[model samples]
Target: MELDDLDWKILALLQEDGRMTFTELAKRVSLSAPATTERVRRLEAAGVITGYSATVDPQRVGLPIESIVRVRVRSLDTPRFRTNVLVLPQILGADHVTGDDCWLLRVVCRSMVELEQLVEEAQRYGDTTTSLVFSSHVRNRPVDISIFVGIVSR
Candidate 1:
């Protein structure tokens, strides 16, 4: 799992274009095709590269609305509310956090009505606050090789 600068460069490139062929990636990073392929394989083997996927515009795909819902569970004691949180399909990300709320969710909905419905359904478990995210400054970012190597060194 020890990755050098080259590995981080490959990862950063792949994060932007997962479908890049080994030849193309090799050209970008000045590695041989086999070397590029092997590096990608190693990253995959070490679980650094989990999988490849396409980045689609949600609005173009018909789901235009993107929002985050903050949930405050009444009974934060047990597993019942936790189960409910995972079963919701519109939810993209969910976290049990350290602040005031019990959970925060990143959700996408087709319309305001649908978003309202989802929030209402979520009320069975807790009170929810819906906020429409106008624009995302950064979605995901590449990891620093320095940080990765430091953590791996330990």
Candidate 2:
């Protein structure tokens, strides 16, 4: 999908507010509602627009403890570790990455004891290092289209 300026604008607007109506988006972009709708549809079909979701505050919702858990899994236990983590509700997100630690997880728990239990479970796979989050500078910022200007053009 070759995204022209209009498509980029639509993406920016939608990222800022996914709930924005097509008509409203059209007005801002100086295009007809149906045209804007079609462009959005194209973006979705091309896999650029994956899905819309509500951002929830973990602290407000009773899960106040947020931590980053890094796990260095034994090569033999990688599959088992992946399988086990899927059922853990405390794990908000996980990324398999390149480093001394094979897995980085965003975890939220109701209390420190719960986090300790989670760490113990993870230790079954391999060594674990966990750090509680004090603050977040950027939570969920919108994607800046300007960053991709040259690359997208090429």
Candidate 3:
């Protein structure tokens, strides 16, 4: 879908606050509530707006420790390893990537013992290199849609 300036503005506002009502968004974008709602619905239908979700602080929710686990799996066990990782509650996100490690996982645990246990369970599938996160500088930032305004993709 080709996005205009108004659509970009609507996306920017929605990214900042997903819960914003259509009336409020319409006011900001200088459109009628019905028009804004239709535009948002079209964006969703086009898969530009995937889903809305709340951002929560993992530490505040009692899972304080965060670790990045780089996992190297045997070629034959890759599928089984991915299935195992999906069922592990401590894993927040998993990425299949290049380099030495086939998978990178974002994990959160309540304590060091829990982290150890999680890693031990993961070891059955692959060799893992885990690094504890001290602090995050930036995370979950809104995408800049301005760059794609007039770009044509082949």
Best by lDDT: 2
lDDT score, candidate 3, position 66: 99
How high is the lDDT of residue 5 in model 3?
Answer: 81
Off by over 4 Å in 2: 150-154
lDDT of candidate 1 over 1-154, digit per residue (tens): 7777788888878877888999999998899999999999999999999998766678898888999899887765337766765577778788888767878989988999999988887787777888899999988565544465433320
lDDT of 2 by residue, 27-146 (tens): 988999999999999999999999999999999999999999999999999989988864699998898999899999999999999999999999999999999999999977888887
Total backbone collisions, model 3: 0
- Estimated TM-score per prediction? 0.80, 0.94, 0.92
User: Predictions ranked by lDDT, top down?
Assistant: 2, 3, 1
Residue 53 lDDT (model 2): 94
Residue pair clashes in candidate 1: none
What's the CA RMSD of model 1 in angstroms?
3.9
Candidate no. 2 TM-score: 0.94
